[model samples]
Target: MKLSSRRKAIAPATRPAAVKAGKCPICGKPQDAGYRPFCSKRCSDIDLGRWLGGRYAVPGEPVSTRTEEDDEE
Candidate 1:
């Protein structure tokens, strides 16, 4: 119920290591069904969308609107 600091830090290490040890990547709680890392089709697709969508990105600056052509452009 109570994890020591060491255990808390090591907790994350355990899941990925399951993969490193040849376990499922998705869910990380199921058997690998030839998904190679991911445990299921759903999680695999979710991760793919995250990477492709630019979700992890810096905040974009707002465009200035002082130019006369700004409305046309």
Candidate 2:
């Protein structure tokens, strides 16, 4: 009985969780059917709040200034 309960609890957690365009990045909550992307209105609003709250950000890459033969050429 304990094993069954544990299995049930762990079943959903074991499912594939991804950061797709329409899926929630913070949690594995499915996109809402009405929200058309988020699993629910609350999740969708939360995502928006995070964005508005500046929780998400774009990462920058390091730039290379010198060429391999800069001195020679």
Candidate 3:
């Protein structure tokens, strides 16, 4: 095969388009590569705070603390 033909076939496979990053969830701003989904450290901290502060909770049924033995007693 000619060098030019081989080059054309490999070029597309080697080169890929840049991936677009999504906006920050905490704030509506473009995401930074360093902070990932968050735009900055501030936003990242805010998200962490929310989780630690019990603001974000998982949905589930309440667990029963009492047993049948407790009722008998």
Name the best candidate (by TM-score): 3
Which sections of candidate 3 miss by over 4 Å?
A: 1-20, 55-73
lDDT-wise, the better of 1 and 2 is 2
| Residues 1-73 of candidate 3: C-alpha lDDT, one tens digit per residue | 5767766665445333323547788887888999978999999999998887675576567999999889983
Question: Model 1: clashing residue pairs?
Answer: 25-37, 26-38, 26-39
**lDDT of each structure?**
0.64, 0.66, 0.79
Query: Model 2 misses residue 15 by how many Å?
Result: 12
How close to the true structure is residue 70 of candidate 2, measured as C-alpha lDDT?
89
Could you tell which candidate, 1 or 3, scores higher by lDDT?
3
TM-score of each: 0.40, 0.37, 0.46
For model 3, which pairs clash?
Answer: none
Question: Residue by residue across 1-73, what tens digits does model 1's lDDT show?
Answer: 4556665565444566554566455556565566656667777787687677677664588977688777685
Ranking by lDDT: 3, 2, 1
Model 2, 1-73: lDDT tens digits are 3666765565454434354445655466666668756677777788788787675555456878878788684
Better of 1 and 2 by TM-score: 1
